[model samples]
Target chain A: MNMTFFQKFFLFFSLAIVCAGCGTDETMESQSSLDINPLSAKPSLFDQSPSNMAKESLMEYEEITGIKAVNSDKEMIIAVQIKHMKRFFMAKHRKAWQKEMEKQFPGWKVELSTDRKIYLELDKLEEKINKDTLSKDELKKEMKHIIKLSKEQT
Target chain B: MIFFWAFVVGGIICVIGQLMFDVFKLSPAHTLTILVVFGAILDGLGLYEPLIDFAGAGATVPITSFGNALVHGALQEADKHGIIGVVTGMFEVTSAGISAAIIFGVIGSLLFKPKG
Candidate 1:
């Protein structure tokens, strides 16, 4: 159909408004997941060593879900995979939380791999915390405990 | 149908420009420049605020939006520093985008061996 310029402008303008409006509900629904404060909440340090602190943080994360953290010094990587329903949302929160952890630890560098892997340096660990490497299960358990500690802090 | 609507909206904007040129006997270059300046001025006056409120991406994802950004930046700078506004203005507004473009362009040029 032949439409006048004004008609066409209004039609497209209205359509844009409708499309934006439709997404508003979904955006509102997603707002809770986007809450920055929860992720911003400070994580208490139970382990002094950078490796142990990273391990402890990962263990806490695992406790919340059944995920496992794998640390690799050679590659400078630590990562966890979880099948949580809110995986994407939780991952975003975890990233923010990791940033807070980095700030808390200071002097130690932390890097998160693109594939949701977290890596930490062993030398940066506090002298008091044990430097011994954790097995997969031990890491998982420790991560759970860390999550519990984090929740209690909240 | 969507493409039709896109064409229609784009055509309307062009048609308005054409009408302004024909009625006022404005040269094509002058008309184009005037349209850009007018858009910038309206954006500066905050008249584009309602348009942005109504059509978020529609108002923003256009060349006119750049004009709006420039005007907005100029105004913001004017607020801080009275007369030397224009010089400091564009940097405050478009710095991030300009920096990214420059950095990426340099990196892309260096890395990519483009075919003639």
Candidate 2:
């Protein structure tokens, strides 16, 4: 019944390993499923896009500034964030991205910011979406508002 | 073929984990969180998918695989809910494992006692 720290640790570690392996068998299936090409429905190692343009734009942004975009939705929202220090330089690209998105969304816009709080709201908003309390358009609007607030947060 | 690769890959990932626990002095909780977070980052970057493809279960069964599941869930949510999917997708991937852990862990604590 008596145990040392290592004994407790060993017991817990073994349990973790055993439990880790014991979970549902979907991990491999899930990963392999991504191997399916949207273009072909057949398996493929190439063409995971609709992200191609976003990737290109982000590359251009990084190439000139030597800073990478930390993240981007790039499609629905064109939501993106640069490193905190680099956010000051985001104005031109933000404007450009907004102009580009206008073709599809008209009054819709894009933004660039380094705000940390929007992420917290994003978490809550995500929950609301899951619960079905918010309409789809409302979620989109909330996201855009958050992204804009992120850009304006300085 | 898949099972062999799964064992090898899964073993190597677990070995790295064990080493971190032994040599680097990372607690099991912190190590587990780190692995999952690291995997999620890789998944977000579009890198982990290929690694998963190569390693199969070797890549997918470990803690990092949980991170991939998080990304997968989030991506699916994004499709359904728009931008917030990025936030909402956190735990859906590993929900099953988590549920099992909680249930079994509580039972073990009730039945087993550690003497100090």
Candidate 3:
């Protein structure tokens, strides 16, 4: 029952692939120090806000580095930057967060995404809102645009 | 770090191919065919997408990913249009790669002659 070198090597490689499939990815450490504070702890954008609650809840997860959220009367949109490695399981994380958020705020539509483009758009929206540069109608239109972008397949 | 992982994963894949050729006395064609089929199987099992997510271009750059793409396109279209979709969608994602291979193969043949 002597195995050739090729057979031995093949067996080892198969074991390795199986072990790799079994292993779960660990969440990576924060890369940058930007906005290390929780969004709820940040300077008040609005009091008793559902958007703030959404951001705060998102920040509790270590993989979420930065979060931007804005809500209309019926819809709450959230964008988060996940740690690079954890992005491998991003679909899973997003689904879990979506369920939790929907549960927390019943009757409110919770839209969560980890797309880089969405994050950048939300960041711009946050800046405009902070500066009070956007009118109510303008904010509503922008949110609608972002939601449309999220729904895009490509 | 991302680059590092990409190199490591891509290199490992190449190494495995090399081993199959050198140790098992497999021809290059046989080795490549086996790898591509292996990739398609992985994709069928819903495993290759996670690998691509984890390794980025490291996973996508290999020949294995070509098979994964072919199966993925077929499966996606099959869900929408049934049996006909499998044939129609087989090349949706892989048409670019196949076209490039043909064009490059012509260029390569024009540039060099095989002695054997």
| Candidate number with greatest TM-score | 3
Tell me model 2's lDDT, rounded to 2 decimals.
0.56
| Model 3 lDDT tens row, A1-118 | 3578889998997886555544423223335433422333223233227788777777788787788888767788888877767867887888899898999889988889977789
Model 3 C-alpha lDDT per residue in residues B1-116, reported as the tens digit of each score: 44545666798999999999999999999999999998999999888877776677788899999999999889879999998999998988888888999999999999999989
Q: A1-154 in candidate 2: lDDT tens per residue?
A: 5568879999997876565555424443343322111121112222214323433454445412221121123323333444323333445555675565455334423343323365356546534543556654565577666766765510
C-alpha RMSD of each candidate structure in angstroms: 14.6, 16.3, 8.3
TM-score of each: 0.34, 0.40, 0.70
Clashes of each: 14, 0, 0
Clashing pairs in 2: none
- Tens digits of per-residue lDDT, candidate 2, B6-116, equal 666788889988988999999999989889898889888877766564556678778898888888888878888998986896676668878999999999999999887
Candidate 3 docks with a DockQ of 0.19
Model 2 stretches with alpha carbons more than 4 Å out: A1-154, B114-116
| CA-based DockQ, model 1 | 0.05
A37: Cα error in model 3, Å: 7.3
* Better-scoring candidate (TM-score), 1 or 3: 3
Error of 3 at A56 (Å): 0.9
DockQ of each: 0.05, 0.03, 0.19
CA lDDT of every candidate = 0.49, 0.56, 0.78
